[model samples]
Target: MNLKKLLVLVLVMHSDAGIAQNLDTPSIKETSGYTLANLSIDSQITMFYYTDITPAVHFYGDILGLEKTLDWSWVVFFQTGSSSFIGLVTEGHDAFHDVQPSNAVMLSLVTNDLDLWYERLRQWNEVTFLKSISDSGPIRSFMVEDPGGYTVEFFQWLTPTE
Candidate 1:
């Protein structure tokens, strides 16, 4: 296998370590400071989705909604009904590959109305590659992206009416 092909294969198999590290960071808050002694070391899965947004991800702010919240270049924060929370941060925030923005990580979001979200996202010229919705086991999902080039997925998990 050629070097480029091998590299692509590796990337496909594993998520970027840089993104995992950024997600594990004690606190992503730039303005606020938190130390180890002051921080609660909780062992949990928190997804910090990132992208290579120019001008640093920190320059952005949060766009809060009823169920989801998107941070400027920083991250899109979401909490599942199970009480699990994830932060989607854009690239160029911490030290990673080159100081400039290039590529970050994949981010996902859940919505009750997948079609409505798709329609709204379509109206925005920035969004690209509107994938078709897929039904898998218990959920129907689709994907899209923001203007900054980060993949955003919308999913709706179905519950058996029984």
Candidate 2:
């Protein structure tokens, strides 16, 4: 048998030689520091900057139906019922960001209502297609451009996440 399969069989049999290695090394917290390693992260947000944030806000909030968690004159935060968030920010004096609108960021939304979202967004005037709805064995998905020119994808897992 191959080395990997043999090792797997040996481990399955609980052989002494197959015991896990015991290494004495500094913990990951040592490098990252106690504060960061122990930080209670509530949400992860992918932010996009735009000269005009209104259209992007409507796309994510109105069309996608994500709940608004925070809103200000220059920024808005939306949550997808989890610790992950999406922030839309205006690229001007209020937020102190002067960067150009970026298309490098892609927002991926996982959902059970794939068809519902596809139908809803396809009807929106701001929707621009990047990819048509299609299946790839493990997932059914489609991609489109949001008002800010960022790629947005909606996907449904054909099978439960492994």
Candidate 3:
């Protein structure tokens, strides 16, 4: 089976939320034996891009210990959980640049301790902290630009009692 078909089968089987009526379903063309599916992702998936050469794969693999689902061309997919994935794509690559690429998208991360990441990132020479811990009402978070200009955020939500 082709990669497209394989992806469809995997998604269909592992879909956390049942397919709703409004969802554009994947249809197979009879003659071609190929299916055309909308790349409409569920809410859990996130895609991030990098412009210059960076060790994103290493960071996700070695540091974060995420297994690669697919690594091809300028795109790399890392499986975060059973149903979630993290996408890393080369910014200048045709696949990504064909559409407008924006650095304005801030990746928000909910972690156990924001200070742990904030302290750890300080040891990395390549990473730059954009802001110290900032309060957003009930949450305390910090933003750091990674080696490839992608903002890696770490945050913790404050409880009402705390």
Model 2 regions more than 4 Å off: 1-39, 94-97, 160-162
lDDT of 1 by residue, 80-155 (tens): 4355555555546652433225435444455688778667655645446557777754557776644454455677
Question: Can you list the residue pairs that collide in candidate 3?
Answer: none
For every candidate, C-alpha RMSD to the true structure in Å: 11.7, 9.8, 10.2
After superposition, the stretches of candidate 3 with alpha carbons farther than 4 Å from their true spots are 1-43, 62-66, 80-82, 91-102
Tally clashes: model 3: 0
**Tens digit per residue, CA lDDT, model 2, 1-162:** 443563355345454542233222266446755533345667688888888888988888898888999999689999965788888889875765554645665676778999998898888776898889998645688999888788887877676466
Q: Candidate 1: where are CA atoms >4 Å away?
A: 1-104
Query: What do the candidate models score in CA lDDT, each in turn?
Result: 0.50, 0.75, 0.65
lDDT of 3: 0.65
lDDT at position 157, candidate 2: 64
User: So what's the TM-score on candidate 2?
Assistant: 0.71
